[model samples]
Target: MSKKVILITGASSGMGKETAKALIQEGHTVYTVARRIDHMQDLKNMGGYPIQMDVTNENDIQNVVDTIIKHESKIDVLWNNAGYGLYGAVEDIPVDEARKQFEVNLFGLATITQKVVPYMRQAKSGTIINTSSMGGKMYTPMGAWYHASKHAVEGFSDCLRLELQEFNIKVVVLEPGVIATEFGEVMLKNISQFSSKGAYSSLTNQLVTATKKMYDKGQGSKPTVISKTVSKIVNETKPKTRYRVGLWAKPMVWMRIYLGDKLFDKIIMSQLS
Candidate 1:
């Protein structure tokens, strides 16, 4: 494979960081960005460039694209992987907080893509990989906003795939299952703060305990699984429009598809019990 210039967001930790390392190891010119540039020191040491960027900031997004274009002339791949799970009952999470979730997960991703797509169209060759989740396809308790954002990502990618085909720009969506990242911890904190003493406190407590057990037992796949999957996607001449990786990702999506809403709800609720 030719050495291609790649850009990845949310590279401060977890899947994004792992993907950056893998791509650099493959001899690609990688520029990784996240709010925490200090966290990417190791990536820089490994010959990958790191930029400090907040995905919600348009100026930051513009700066990142301009810098990459100025340096590499063309970006061969764009990985939109910056997002966080906001876990709390829809009734309890303030609308402002919910909007913030979309700002980072959906709108921010869309903005970055908009800035980069023109360049890719001019070059007539590029790949755009978006990070959705199993939750995008299936709903879970206390993740209303997060799931909605990811579901939006799925639809967004589908339409973009069709539109970009003429331009030779590929749009792929990644549906990651449970990966051992800061996700569990951050989610637990949010749910507790938002709903622990509210009308859904009982369900909130149950979910909190269950989530703790799942992650504490190391049941989630390692971040490297996603990294390897991304590497595969990046190198494929004709990659699938969607790739599902990590533990429980495939099975959960399947259950949601075949089991119907009532049965799927039963299974998910049974877990909380």
Candidate 2:
């Protein structure tokens, strides 16, 4: 396989960092970015370029793209992976907070994609890998805003794939379920702060306990699972438009599909009970 110049966001840790390391080891020129640049010094030490970037900031996104193009002359792949999970009851989460969720998880990804697409289109060949979640396809209690943002990503990526087909830019969505990352800590933190003493207090407590139990028991798939998926998909000439990997991703999606709304709702709520 030819060594491709790649740009991946949210690369300070977790799946993004792992994938960046794997790609660099394979001899690809990789530019990794996140809001926390210090978290990525190890990646820089491994021959990957690390940049401090906030996806919500347009100037930061533009600068990262410009820097990559200046050095590599072209970008062969863009992995839009910079996102966080916000969990709380809809009524408990302020409108501004909800908007911020969309800004990071949906709009930010889109803005970065917009910046990179022109370069890919000019070259007539490139890949855009978007990191979504099984939550995009399924839903859980007290997670309305988070799921809404991911759902938007699913729709946005689908439309983008159709639009970019003529340009030969492949758009792929990754739906990972229960990866063992700081995702749980971040999510629990947000939920506890927002709903720990509201109408949703009981639900919040149950969610926190259940989430902790799941993670403590090591139910989450390792981050390497997703990193390997990134490696495999980039090598494919005609990769699938969407990949549902990691533990429970496929089954949860299947359950949501085959079961009616009432049954699926019961199943999901039972987990919190």
Most accurate candidate by lDDT: 1
Candidate 2 yields a Cα-based lDDT of 0.94
Please report how far candidate 2 places residue 10 from its true position, in Å: 0.4
* TM-scores of all candidate predictions against the true structure: 0.99, 0.99
The candidate 2 region of ten consecutive residues with least summed lDDT is: 84-93
lDDT, candidate 2, at 67:
93
Write the residue-wise lDDT of candidate 2 on 1-273 in tens digits: 989999999999999999999999999999999999999999999999999999999999999999999988999999999889999889888999999999999999999999999999999999999999999999999889999999999999999999999999999999999999999999999999899996889999999999999999999999999999999888899999999999899999999999989999999989989
* CA RMSD per model (angstroms): 0.6, 0.6
Residue 260 error, candidate 2, Å: 0.9
lDDT of 1 by residue, 1-273 (tens): 878899999999999998899999999999999999999999999999999999999999999999999998999999999999999999999999999999999999999999999999999999999999999999999999999999999999999999999999999999999999998998999999999996999999999999999999999999999999899889998899999999999999999999999999999999999
